[model samples]
Target: MASDVRFSDSRVGVSTPLDSLREVLGVPDLDTALLTHALTHRSYAYENGNIPNNERLEFLGDSVLGVVVTAALFRTHPDLPEGQLAKLRAAVVSAKALAEVAIELQLGQHLLLGRGEETTGGRRKASILSDTVEAIIGAIYLQFGIERASEVVHRVFDPFIARAAEMGAGLDWKTSLQEIAADHGLGVPRYVLEGTGPDHDKTFTAEVHLGGERLVVVGAGAL
Candidate 1:
């Protein structure tokens, strides 16, 4: 909402690395400066003499995400109760959910983190990744207003919302699996996660076990 904000390259151009990211986000005209601000972590700012960071944008984006997701759930599920809607919203907007979306966008590679954070594996941290997603959303809102922001939000988040809806009263996939196991008297489901490859391009394999038997194994590429 602040019109006076400025960045070295205020207008994003084809020469910038962010041009590809802008294309992925379907917001080709987004200000490069704003996008850079959104990607800047506090540690990066602190290391650089307290320059601006993404915290403010993250805050604005969190609210925008909540509002957009809530409206979508309300309109899309007119027959659902308030409690169910709340659960669906929670599932779609959770930190883990947002982090998954961030991973899909390959956002970590583009983040601006301090050297210390980089050494400590900050890129894979769910909090930072999720916060960055919010910051980007905030940047979009600031640049284009809620209408355009809503369009982007829907594009990225609608599938997750629909998936959550299909989970019925179980909310997320984990909870749905748990409920199903409980109903079948299969005991609790246990998850084992293993990561392979280098820090920058690790692949994760998750195995779900029930009653001491491995039920499924799923793999995901680097975040």
Candidate 2:
């Protein structure tokens, strides 16, 4: 599979190569055109003469992802209530979680972006990365069918689902912390957030306070 062929975005005169991406996705036989479309962000499409974007595919993929995740959760955690199951699904399918998966797959490098988006660090944006993941799923489903798409979804998301199940209420740290604090008669947990740097690239610092005493301060850079 010589996957290194260039698909040109004519308006921007940009060429996106999919060889590395195909290997990373573990879907070598995916149709090049479909895969290219999956990687095409709206910014890129708009800049390149308003060509089709990945939004439709993202929509389709969202449904596919939901079904697979829901079915798996239903089957595996037969004892869980509906509320817990919904929470588990939300945790796994959230933008943050999907973005983490995209980062692991190095999907950022494969995104097709416009000049503005590329310069503004759109590749690392959680929203774009997550949508792209879904678009890829849509492409896989269209090309290969539901069974193969489910395999890919499981490969990327099963660990997240399992961790969410294990964590249960802990998946929502703020709520979990508040509950623990309430039980311990510590009043309520207060969170103070501070953001720094440019809007396109920012670093966030969070402080957790209990009983008017600051307990933890942690900083994380935005992706």
Which candidate comes out best when scored by lDDT?
1
Using Cα atoms with residue i matched to residue i, what is each candidate's TM-score against the true structure?
0.73, 0.70
Top candidate, metric TM-score: 1
Question: When superposed on Cα atoms, how far off is each prediction in RMSD?
Answer: 9.2, 9.7
lDDT digits (tens) for residues 1-223 of candidate 2: 6532234334244334776676667776677778889999989999989888888889989999999999998998898768678878888898998999999999999899999999999999999999999999988998788999998999888888788775466567677677667878889887778898999988888788897585755656676
Q: Tens digit of lDDT per residue, candidate 1, span 137-213?
A: 99999988999999999989988978877544555668667766887888889988889998888888888888758
TM-score of 2: 0.70
Regions more than 4 Å wrong, model 1: 1-4, 7-14, 171-223
| Per-residue error (Å), model 2, residue 118 | 0.9
Clashes of each: 0, 0
